[model samples]
Target: MEDFVYFFSFQDPNVAMVVAGITLLSISAAMVGTFTFLDKKALLGDAISHAVLPGVCLAFMFAGSKNPYWIVLGAFITGAISTYAIEWISNSTKLKEDTVIAAVLSVFFGIGILLLTQLQQTGDAALSGLDHFLFGNAISIVYEDLMVYGILALLVIICILVFYKEFKLIIFNPSFAESVGLPVKRLKLLFNTLLVMAVVTGIQAIGVVLMAALLITPPAAARFWSNRLHVILMLAVLFAVLSGIAGAFISFAVPHMPTGPWVVMAISFIAFASFFFAGKKGILSKWYNQRNYQQKIHRDHILKSLFQALEKNSKTLEKDEIMEYFPGKEKLTRTYISKLEQENKIELEGEKLKLTPSGLVEAKRVVRLHRLWELYLAQYLNLAPDHVHDMAEKMEHLLTPELEAKLDASLDYPTQDPHHSKIPRDNDL
Candidate 1:
């Protein structure tokens, strides 16, 4: 905990500034990333990240130094060109999107590597830190580099805020937006430009290789936690910021470690957690809900068996006879019966199993729904009476009150089902 306190204490202004710069870059990338993820253009971010490498190397060669302006300009140019080429290839050829992206990524990265190798062979002192762009040296980002990143981050944030509604419309229904004269094409171009700008800004702090994670994973992870567009954007920004901070701190604490991979690792950790723990859509929650629903079905089926036994024999069913209905599911049936009894839905008197009044009403309701559905399918859907019973057996438990009402109205209040069984009346059991 002492290490944690020291990390946040701002004992060194350089550490504080590096953290701030990482936070800014992360927020910007995450905001743009959310739109890309929603639009199913996540691979485009990866393409841009790799494709910007040639531009950075060219900028260094032209400027003869590690100048921010030259690097950013070159990056923007290459990134934009890569995006246009991807679109053009996709439209003009039969190649799939993944194929186009992979092609562009490999070509551009190869060129960048070639240029870097040539520069290294020259033994130029100005190109000393050029290799750092492959991984990242977040702690080495000076104040000047931070200023450039900060300005770019600000521009990205402003653009997103101003065009929030338009972007959302384009993502969800581009054809409709175009029909409404919203300039969908121009909006896409502008969005792509912003994405490129985001990639360029992080080239130094996060690097080209792992920078795609900054622009993809946070937003992808955030999506599991929200459906609202605004909420998703906010959550994505929060996740990105957390990852950036953690990555920067780890780089600080552990000497010589690259910050980009650490940042990706942090973002992935959050994403994995969200997949398993977030409410409503999470895997664990889904499993729990499914288990509970199955338990409910089992209890209802038990009550149904008791009602059927009483209908046939005019007496309670023996526990052993009820267990026979479940065959190999004796343990599950036993637990279900115990739970039903605990809930006062069923009674166990000696060896006899009987439903309480509440259980009888519920069982009748389930049976009534099943028979009503069978009749509806047989008469209205033109399904054979023999085929309708099996279908209704599955549909009965899932019918909602509104659906039941619709079915009742459609069937015109039938008195007897296709199987010749009397349909239970509202007050009859």
Candidate 2:
């Protein structure tokens, strides 16, 4: 608890630097990633992250030390190459984008590993922590390291803000954007540059392997909560910041644990929670809506069945007779009947069931819709009367009052269905 408090207090400059740097990196990755996700180019992030490893190695060779500028330039160059190669292969050949990305990611990453191993053999003290780039050690980020990657992250954020509309246009409808003279090709190139820089910024803190999570997972999870691009971008940034802070704190508190994996783990948990809990699109929401829909269907079926019985004898229905209407679904029918009675749609006198006045009106409305739809289908769709009944059975519960009026007017009042049964109305009730 003390460690957690101290981590947030910023009394220790190193902890503050690492935490602040991570926050900036998160914002950059999330902003760029939202478009990458919308463009269906999520794998581009993964490919660029892996491809930067070779650049890191090449940078070390050129500087003879881990110089931040050389390393970033190298990573960005390699990442840019990987991005363009993916596009070229996809456009020039029959190979899919995923296949090209996979190929580029593997080759570049493997070359990086080979070069890094050679550097390790030299036993230069500067080359000692190069492996940390694969998985991050956030605690190792100092003010200087922060300045190097942090400024790049800030640049990415600025670029995203400046070109937000163009990015949206290209992601959602590039052809339309081009028609409107939006310089789509140039914008794509620029967006790709920002994407590479975002990956580059995170490699030192979040690391190469898991930086893709910081890039894509926040936006992917945010999509569940919103439809608007701007709202989604804000949510993605918020999610990324929270997850980055959590991982950074864990790394600060725990010994020998890298920040990148913990961040990925934190983000993964968040993604799962959003999947099951977000409003409208979540698993729980969908399940609850479906359950309510099913219950409503059962209620409507019971009401219509009781109305049909009333038409037959103009008398109350005994429990056994009502249950007999749905032999295999006796349990369901009984439950729906009890619910309808509580709602005052029906009255239960001992074991007999009778429709209340309101219930009679509702039941008639349901029947009216069923008959009207059947008439329309039989007359206009040329479906046989027998064929129309089954279709109308499903439509009765779904048709709105406005739709019912429209159907009534369109069918010229539809006094009788094709089967010659009278279509009951509120006045008739």
lDDT of 2 by residue, 1-429 (tens): 999999999999898898889999999999999999999999999999999999999999999887889989999999999998899999999988889889999999999899989999998987878888999878888878899999999999999999998899988888999999999889999999999999999998899889999999999999999999999999999999999999999999998889999999989888888899999899998999988988887788778888988888765888898778778988888888888988999998898899999999999998889899999999899998889988998888887788889989999997789999999978884
Kindly give the stretch of ten consecutive residues in candidate 2 with the minimal lDDT sum. Answer: 310-319
Per-model CA lDDT versus the true structure: 0.88, 0.91
For residues 1-429, write the lDDT of model 1, one tens digit per residue: 665677789898888888888988998999999999999999999999999889999999899999988988998999999999999999999999999999988999899889989989999888888888888778888888889888998899899999999999999999999999999989999999999999988998899999999998988888888899899899999999999999888888888888889998999999999999888788998999988888777777898788777668655888889888999999999998888889888898897888888888888878778889899888778998899977887788888889888887888877788988877765875
lDDT of 2: 0.91
Candidate number with greatest lDDT: 2
Model 1, total clashes: 0
Which regions of candidate 2 deviate over 4 angstroms? Answer: none
TM-score of 1: 0.95
The superposed Cα distance between candidate 2 and the true structure at residue 195, in angstroms, equals 0.9
Of candidate 1, the 10-residue stretch with the lowest lDDT total is: 307-316
Clashing pairs in 2: none
> What's the lDDT for residue 33 in model 1?
95
Residue pairs in clash, model 1: none
